[model samples]
Target: MADNTAAKIEADASEIITSPRVEVGTRGVNRVDTVYASIMDAMSNGEFPESGRLPTETELAQRFGVSRPTVREALSRLRLDGLIASRRGSGSFVLRRPDRNIKRFAPIESLADVQRCFAYRIALESAAAGLAAELRTPRDLDEIARALEHLDRVREQGTLGVDEDLQFHLAIVRASQNIFFVTALEMVGDQMRVAMQLSRSLSLERSKVRREVVQAEHREIVNAIDKGSSVEAAEAMRLHLGNARRRLFEGPQSE
Candidate 1:
C-alpha cells in the first residue's frame, strides 16, 4: 500500500512537470520570475501549509527541470522580497504572501510616461543625494564607487549600461542612510528600471560627445558627495537630471 501511494505521488509530480511551459524568456520575464510565480501558485493552492517548510533546493531543481543555480536565484529573490525565510541548519520556509499594498507605478507605455518618471525622480532623488552627501559613511562611499566603476566599464564596452546606471543611482539613495528614501525607490523599482532603459536607448542614439558630458555630470555629483557638500551635491543631481530630460526630448532635430 505504501509503494502504491509513493507511485501515485510521483505520477502527480510528473503531470505537473509536463504541463504547458510558462513563458519565461520574453522581455521582462526571466527564469527567476517564472520559478517564483510557480512556487507562489503552489502555496496559494494549499500544496504547502502556512508553517510548512519548502523542499530542498535539489528537489526544487528537479521539479522545475532547471539548474540548481536557477532555483537558488529564485529563492534568493523570494527571500529578499520577504516572501520566504531561511534557517542555517534547516531549509527555507514561506513567510507570507507578498504585500499587495506596496504602491507601484504604472508601466511606461510611452515617452511621456518616461518623462513623468524622471520628473518624479528629480524631486525625490535630488533630496536623497543632498542627504547622502551629509550622511554617507566610508562603506557607503565604497558601494557608490563600485557602481560607478561598473558604469565606466560598461560604457567603455559601448553598451547602454542601463543596469549599471540604475545601480549607481540606487547606491546613492542607499548612501542617504534614510530608510524612507530607500523604501520609496524600492516601491517603484519596476517603473524605475523601464525609465532607465528608455532613457539609455535615447542617450545611445546621440553623439559620443553628449555621452561624455553626461558622464562628467555623474562625476560632479560624486565629487560633491565625496567632499560632503550637500548643497552642491543636490544642485549637481538636479542639473544632471534636467539635462537628461532635455537630451531625451529635444536632441538634434531630424532633417
Candidate 2:
C-alpha cells in the first residue's frame, strides 16, 4: 500500500514538473497557498497512500520547488483543517479525502475572513468544551440537549439549522460556567452567524450522508462532556470545528 501510494505521488510530481509552470508569488499569490492547493488537488486525485503516510517535508519542499518552511506552513493548515495528522516520530498521514463535489458559495466576507473566524472558534470553543466537561451542571447538559434537539427538528423539516447549530455551540460555552467566554462569543455573534449560515447552507445542499456527519460531530462533543473527560472534550471540539471548516471550504461537491 505504501509503495503504491508513493508511486502515485511521484506520478503527480512528474505531471506538475512537466506542465507549463507558473511562477510562484506571481500576481500577488502566496507560496503557501500554492503548495496547499497542490496537495489538495493531489488528494482529490486519489494520490495518497493507503497507509496514510505522507511524504516527508524535505521531499515535499523539493517536489514543489519551495522552501521547507513554505511546505511546513501548508501542512500546518492541512492539519488544522483536519485533513491530515502529524505525529512526532512517524510524520504526517491523510485522515480523509477532500470532497470533490462541493458547491461553491460566495462568501459574505472574504474567504480569508471566514477562515480566520474558524481559526478563532477552534481555539475559543475547544477551550470552552474542555471547561464545560469539568464544570457542567445538569442544567447545562439540558441546554445543550435542547439545542441539539432543535437542530434535528429543523434538519428534518428541510430547513437549514444554522440558528440551532449556533445555539448548540453557545450552550457548550455557557456550560463552562464562565460568563466571560459567553461574553466573548456574544460579541462575535454576527460573525458566527455569517459563518454558520455559509457552512450550514453548504451542508444543506450536499447529500444526507454529509449532513448526518455534521450531526455526528455535534454528538461527539456532547458525549465527551457527558463523560466528564476534559481532554477528550477539547479534542472532540477541535476536531469538530476543524472538520466543519473542511466541510464548508474543502468538501467535495455533488456529482
Candidate 3:
C-alpha cells in the first residue's frame, strides 16, 4: 500500500518535470536515452544482479527524474533486446547462463579434425559456463529461457531436423556475453552442421532421444551459475560436451 502511494507520487512528479509538447526541430539529445544508457550500464556492471531486484518503473522514473512513459520506453527497448523479462505480479529476475568458450579455428578437412575441434572447445566452453553463472546479465538469462523454450517446442513439434544441433549450444555461447567467444564458435558452424547431419543418420536413436535429458543439462549449467560455482559449471560442460563428441565419433557405426 505504501509502496503504491509512493510510486504514484513519483509518477506524478515525473510527469510535471517532463513537458508534453516537443519542438519540431529540437537540437539537443534525448534525456530518456541517457537514462537508458545508465540503466544498461547498471545491469552490465551486475549492480542490479547483486541488488537482486530492479526498481519499479516509477522508482526508476523518480531516480532519473524522467516521465514514467520515458522510463517505460527505455525498459521496452531492453525487453526487446532480450535483456530484461517481465512478470505480471512478481518482478523480473536475472536468467542463468551456460558456460561458453573463446577459440578460433582454421577450416577443417573432415570429421576427424572436428574431433579435436570439439575436444578443444569443450575445455574452454565449460569454464565459460562457470563465468556465465558469475556474470550472466538479465538479458543473458532471458536469451537462455527463450532458447530452452524453443528447444522444447522443436522437440515436441519436430526435430531440429538432425541438422540444427548447434542451435542450443549457440544460445549458450550468446549467454556467455563474450562477443569474441560467440564469434569463435560461429567459425566452425559449417563443419558442425555437416557432422550433425551425419551423426544423426548413423545413430537412428538420436532423433528419438528424449530432449528432457538435454534440457536437464541446461538446467544443470544454470544451477551451477545460480550457486555461483564456476568450477562445477565448467566440469559439467566438459562432461556434457564430451558426451556429445563421443556420439559424434563413436556413434552407432557410421559411413
Ranking by lDDT: 2, 1, 3
> Candidates 1 and 2: which is better by lDDT?
2
Candidate 2 lDDT for residue 212: 79
Worst 10 residues of 2 by lDDT: 101-110
lDDT of 3 by residue, 43-106 (tens): 6455776325679988898998777878776666454334566788866543311011101112
Q: Put down candidate 2 lDDT per residue, 1-255, tens digits, no spaces.
A: 334433533454464356333336757776776777778667756797323788999999999898888888778777766678988899999877665433244422244356657877777787788889989999999999999889878777869877888889999999999999899888888888877877777777677888777888888999999989887788789789877787765554322
Q: Give per-model CA RMSD.
A: 20.2, 11.2, 21.1
* Residue clash pairs of candidate 3: 83-139, 95-141, 99-128, 99-129, 100-128, 100-129, 126-234
Better of 1 and 2 by TM-score: 2
My TM-score estimates for the predictions, one after another, are: 0.56, 0.63, 0.49
Candidate with the larger TM-score of 1 and 3: 1
lDDT of 1 by residue, 1-255 (tens): 334433533454464355343335647555655676677556545575456899999999889877777788667645643457899999999766421211122221243345546656766777788888989999999998898888888767778887898889899999999999898877877877876675576666656777788888998999989999877787788788877765543333310
Q: In model 3, what is the error at residue 89, expressed in angstroms?
A: 68
How well does model 2 score by local distance difference test? Answer: 0.76
- Candidate 1, RMSD to the unseen true structure: 20.2
Off by over 4 Å in 3: 1-109, 161-165, 201-211, 249-255
